[model samples]
Target: MTARCSMRLEERSARHIDFTGREDRPVQIHLRDIKRTPGPPNPAGLDHDMSPPPRLQQVPTSPLLSAFSAHRSETLSAGRALFVEGDSGSDIHLLESGLIALSHIQPNGKRMIASFVVGNGVFSLSHDGMRLLTAEALQECRLRRVHRVELSHLPADQAEAVKAALDREPWDIQAETLMHLHKDADEGISYFLVRLAGRLNGPISRGSRVRLDMSRVDIADHLGLTVETVCRGLKRLRSDRVIDAAGPHNVIILEPDQLKRRAGLGPDFD
Candidate 1:
């Protein structure tokens, strides 16, 4: 990715000024070749569209699942996009299992992950029948798509559940947005981990283990921080004994109260 910088000079050179206010001199730009970090090997034959039309495997069904699966059920292999931004959004999606990411492509072609939909989460309730973000599978996923009209036909209990899920989405997004408001990187990262742990690992206790489904890159994009900042923040958290990194994809909450303190949150924040 090309990095950009802004410059200001009072010399009125009427020419491009470099970072140090040097004018009328060729600004030397250095290109660095950085190797992409290797992640898990891609699943074979799963790229460039899930051929033969992905279908869901049989699983025990529930009232909510049955209602949502009325029209269609599908699966997406890891790394496959379920839908891109600007796609028609007449149907709502219920993620039965695995992880999905909702993101937007900026004008500069950078992707900003808006949120992640964990298992049993409901998403894509678009107000204008238009998708504002793209949805992609972070893991092999099972999902159901139901037409908007079908929501009214669901049983009262199921309808209420759906309503509650939708209701929580805004608050969740708001909390994430608030995380970005903090100027301190560690504070923002701590708050993000706490919110994510609540969603992925249930109630936050000292021993709660959160499976980090999203990568550091994803976290950086979602939190509006550089990857280096995220790395440093996590290092500080570990050093302070607030959390422990079990692996590349697992984190254990060591001192929940301390973590909340670091995040500038109350004990009852979660």
Candidate 2:
């Protein structure tokens, strides 16, 4: 792409999106800035983003946000880093929709997948005294972010309210991923897909299709697996008669119950 951006972090307090080739005004943008390039139906790389980043649209408007005058929004492309660990924590996103892989990059450059946050998940939440981790888009993602100043003003109960919204998703299989420092590629990949199917749609639908919104490579990167292994897991599930590839991005579930059993959930969860 034609849009040139140097790597630097700047603060913003504006009402409009930072589009129109402006210098950094809390606006939204594509991952690589390929403006003229024509995108495809699924545009393998094209983001399924809103026009000017996602608006502050999630329900239960954050009382914390009341302290801030402006907000920043952006759409993240799959596989792109949202924020690397150790970077100064500034803002947090109110994810509209999509799979977000939170992983860690080692000094040796090896990566370890941590968690795949979906739906109304918040990316920055410190609990029991732990710092932030890395976050990246596992698929075309739309997000609205508010600055830390806003967080600082969160009323005790209101702040707790926002935190409660993020918690409650039961920390079982996926929560165990936080401690991983090294990559377990294979097992990690399996756990990720299981969580994805478990998170977005319910488990495999007895005799229906399941759509995989994120790509294999993003899945691999998020799960610490090679692309090949991610594909293998999908094939393995199909072989077991648990699921079927319905189309490029869809999978049919022959036995949703079986898939739930693997994801640490009961068949009667509904």
Candidate 3:
């Protein structure tokens, strides 16, 4: 017997139903033909309700970023490759502005987006001396490239700052792995938005929006879901009033607690 599932977008939510079939072959359902209802209009004066969260206010800049502020920077145009997978890891790339995507290509040639490193972030951290994934600019990016050996030559205080930043890398990697393993598509998307909002240097409050530089396809790749699934998930969120979209790339979180609930995160999570 073959097992099959059918998913339909309800007026207020999305649900899937499973069924058993007598056929000996697996069943595949195509979702390409499904249509999403247009989202509601943005309410007038919605921006006034949004405020920057308290944590975003008065946060100090990273000492590591300050230590390297005087260094010469490099720029890459959108869609340019920063480094290739399996390349020798020679430099740590610090993002000054714009978005960078870290991705891995499987042996089957499928490219999976692992994460996005926004400004004030560092990438290419590995214990082994080789790149495990490729890095590319999602937009025109400004970056500071520091060779590994150069860190040891820095002033003691500056070097310590860099070390402290590097120490947190493992925690981030572990958290990302856990998020992927634990959440379904809907929860994952909500968690991604919350994390992205927290990373932004500016203020984010209820009704405050985050601009997503990546496309829906890119988001799906990062979350390990199909494009259709991401779209359906977003639609459900919007319909439930947990979030709203100003446009395709910008998401305004309407209800932070509700969004966090959808993400399966605790209330204390920023």
Compute the lDDT for candidate 2: 0.53
The total of clashing pairs for model 3 equals: 0
The residue-level lDDT of candidate 3 at 193 comes to 86
- Model 1: weakest 10-residue lDDT segment is 4-13
Which candidate would rank higher by TM-score, 2 or 3?
3
Task: Give the candidate number with the greatest TM-score.
Answer: 3
lDDT of 2 by residue, 67-173 (tens): 22244445676555566555455465667677776656566755555666777666664333343665666556867666545554666865665555446433542
Q: Select the stronger candidate by lDDT from 1 and 2.
A: 1
- The residue-by-residue lDDT of candidate 3 on 1-270, one tens digit each, is 333222122222223211111123332222222222333232110112133445544433766776665456666656545666665675776888898777776767556777888988977555678877667666778787677788888778877887777777657866886788799888998888888888883434688788887766567778988767777888888888888878556788899888888889877776
The per-residue C-alpha lDDT of model 2 at residue 201 equals 71
Q: How much lDDT does each candidate structure score?
A: 0.67, 0.53, 0.67
Tell me the lDDT of candidate 1: 0.67
TM-scores of the candidates in the order shown: 0.72, 0.60, 0.74
TM-score of 2: 0.60
Q: What lDDT does candidate 1 reach at residue 48?
A: 30
